[model samples]
Target: MKILVYGAGAVGGYIGAHLIENGLDVTFLARGGHLKNIVDKGLNIVLSNQEKIVHPSYATDSLATLKNVKFDVVIVAVKAWQVRESATEILPYTSSSTLMISVQNGIDSPYELNDVFEARQIIPSVFRGICLVSEPGVVSVPSQCSWTLGEFQKNPTRAINSLLKPLIGSKLQLKVSIDEDIIKDLWKKLALIAPMSGVGALTRSVLGVCLEIKELRNMIEKAVEEIIVVAKSQNIILPDETLENSMGFYRALPYSATSSMQRDIEQKKPSELEYQTGAIVKLGKSNNVQVPVNSFIYYSLLPQELAARSDLR
Candidate 1:
């Protein structure tokens, strides 16, 4: 399988490293300083509990050089906002049977990429591995995280299994979920991440701190309820116990931990916020759903984000 792992930031880089470690056929698509580092020093991953050098892989920035190369799978790991640009740029790398996997966060990314290509051409999967790029080629993820795969249409057929075979058991836990209502599942996830990322970025604090504040806890519940209403309207049933379960795990996280979105916002780097909390507000308005908590955080964080960006210049 000729796999082209796009973006190679944290998540993409981590996945590529694992695939290469397992002796799978994979090449990284990266740019800028990350591209240079990968070309010169190869890729690196620092596990949550271990020393900072393990998996390795080759990388490059040239799509034209890989023009004749037909990738059996194209893992689109960039943020949602970059889907359009990435698709356009990498158009030549796709072939008829190329499985364009959407391993990004947010409900719209898979759909967004689908519109650019075809819905059937996309393999929608939720990756729970925690990854953050402290530098260009250095990627980090917790050792024991899991990844779930399912088609948007509910059937991860034989073809899907063939594609997932290489990634199944080598260092990453893979499961197949036959949930036809993936939209609801994505929304449920968004419901939690929306508030967590928003609050995390706004406060420069981790989830534990937010959970400690009575007011913030109410805000999070309120946001989840709003998302639940939207999910129910769309005919997706989410268990009432889901929120409590999510909160339990969230609060148990290390106090110093922060969302990748929060890290991007703090670093003044362009982030997936548009696909994170921003998507909720946008979708909520379109569906006549009110997401005040998310809206407040989205707008409030904008100025700080803008100020941070200005300092970069």
Candidate 2:
């Protein structure tokens, strides 16, 4: 099956490198220095133990170059905010049978893609792992990577399995599973990430430091509760134990671990703040759910986020 990894950043780059290593037909759509490095030096994946470099079947920044190629699977690995634009850009290369996978941080990506493609053609996925682009053309995987993908409206399980079958048990340390209800999985992950990232960015600290302080830890717990309430407003009932379970998951993470959004905010780069934390605030307002903790987190971080995107007025 021909696959196109649309945004070859940390997540996309890591997944594409593994697919290429296994001799699959994959093309990467990337831009700027990352694109140049991949074209010249190939894609490099750094694991905990060893490093592997594999050249993709094709990699290009120009969509016109592949105008005639119809991709079977298009993995939309871009940031949450970039999903809609990315979907429009890749539309010319997608046929009715194309499966567009949404593997972004927030819950809005699949819906965003639905504006461009049929809901039946979209697979909502959640990526769980510690991976990042250490440098141009290079991706680092410090922990195991797993994906939970689910169908929306139509059952594309057979097609989805066929597309991901190759990477299932490879030495890439990757895991793949299909969930019956992926929206709940997405909210569960958001409950953990949105609060952690929002609090981490505001404090400019790691997970350990954030949890060490009593006030910050309390805020994080309340933030998770806020998200749960918002999800319930949409009729997605998260487990009653979500708050405690999320805290336990956070505690198990490496002390130095930081969310990608937190790191981006620290570096003054554009982040998923608007899509992750801010999305909860918007949902709460629309649904009449009180999310003071998330509201403080979002509004407090707004100026910096606007500044990072060069819209700080």
Question: Against the true structure, whose lDDT is highest?
Answer: 2
TM-score of 1: 0.87
lDDT of 1: 0.72
So what's the TM-score on candidate 2? Answer: 0.94
lDDT of 1 by residue, 106-220 (tens): 8887777766777777777676645677787777665455556656654545565655677666453323343345566677677767777888788887778888898888877
lDDT of 2 by residue, 198-308 (tens): 999999999999999999999999999999999999999999999999999889888988999999999999999999999999999998899999999999999999999
Question: What are the candidates' C-alpha RMSDs?
Answer: 3.1, 1.9
Clashes of each: 0, 0
lDDT for model 2, please. Answer: 0.88
**CA lDDT of each prediction against the hidden true structure:** 0.72, 0.88
Q: TM-scores of all models?
A: 0.87, 0.94
- What shift in Å separates residue 9 of candidate 1 from its native position after superposition? 1.1
